[model samples]
Target: MLELTTEQVAALAEIDAKRFVEGVRADLCKDDPKLVDDTTFSSRLWRAFKAAREVGIERDENLVAFLRVEAYAPSFYEQPAIRAWLTRPGRSADQRFHDYLRVVRWHIEHPKFQGGLNNGGSGSAGNRGGSASTWSGLGARWRGFIGRGSGGGSG
Candidate 1:
């Protein structure tokens, strides 16, 4: 259920791929400067994250489908092609691109990020629902639109 906060999405929009990945790593790191380092894994993941963010995937609620690539990606968050793909100006609007933003949205907010793999990679998944300003949050807002608990009742 984890979702992207609007602030997170806005911040991501400004960074280049390298910086975007660094931000994801840092988010996984939970403010621990010691963990940031140069490595292929970090670089590739950054590329994937940057690509996804570009397309509006930065804030989706679905987790498993987002990561599946089912063809959305040629590889995981680490592939040279994905790097090129993300930066290609004409490639920005593809539907698959959103998968990156969506997964990272779930990734950083994972309870593990509250601790642990903020040490290595992101931590194990947890079931915390979406934050305000995202798809899952949008659903919640919709319920309110229909008055979920207000007894105003929805059609």
Candidate 2:
């Protein structure tokens, strides 16, 4: 269990869980262009779990159960790993654990997960075509971290 700051927990609490995971998946897919196909629902859920853990989630088993019940998979049949992860319920536990770790690391390394920081002036806050009400916290999290102290963070 990660000991999250009050602000961090607030940030996590503020997230629209579905959008947060989707955004994380989208960000991860930005590079290869084919990365969207390369990613998986399990990876995204693992990401949500870990990100929430940073804000102090204690039970991933519950999270996994939640994912099994609530996860909405976009049609990603092109990516074998992703497709395999989503459609099959009986995959080796080891694979799921590895994917979970990958998701956690991906979240940590992701720019949006950097705590509301910016990206070389590539975009302006509340100015893009995307929904500001949706990703503003994710957009600014990295900026907040960079603009404030080294340990800076927010949604």
Candidate 3:
């Protein structure tokens, strides 16, 4: 579960689940250029889960189950790991939920995840005043991260 300040809890209570979901969806669609290219539903879910956690909503198995069943509906053909995970019956729901959040948090917290913008700048900072070659390096790196072209690959 995420530790929250009083302010965070108050902010969380102000937004109902529906509003939270819409906000997350809008942010992902508008801000994340790589949304369409993402291979798994986890990417989007991670953002929503993170948003909820940031606002002080306590993450639990029920929330995870709701995300999986309603928001994600992940396909085994596209995301086999989730399928394998859901099929496994041994782990408790709480354990699975925690593990899921841990993995998602690790991914999102990476500097390179969700394009270089997650790390710093507008991603255009390197373009403004930096050398052409330097900007290109950043562009190439971001392109690769977002799986843009032939040279681009999954992270």
Which prediction has the highest TM-score against the true structure? Answer: 3
Estimate TM-scores for all models: 0.25, 0.23, 0.29
Global local distance difference test of model 1:
0.43
lDDT of 2 by residue, 6-77 (tens): 999878775655555555455544522443454465465655455434333345453443232223322212
How many residue pairs clash in all the candidates, one count each? 5, 10, 0
Whole-model Cα lDDT of every candidate shown, in order? 0.43, 0.42, 0.44
Quick one: best lDDT, which candidate? 3
The model with the greater lDDT, 1 or 3, is 3
Q: What residue runs in model 1 are displaced by over 4 Å at the alpha carbon? A: 1-20, 30-38, 60-74, 77-155
Task: Encode model 1's per-residue lDDT on 1-155: one tens digit a residue.
Answer: 87889988776765554564554555533433323452444644554554565444544322223322311222343345445544556544344456444444554445355334447745544343533223333333333322342455332
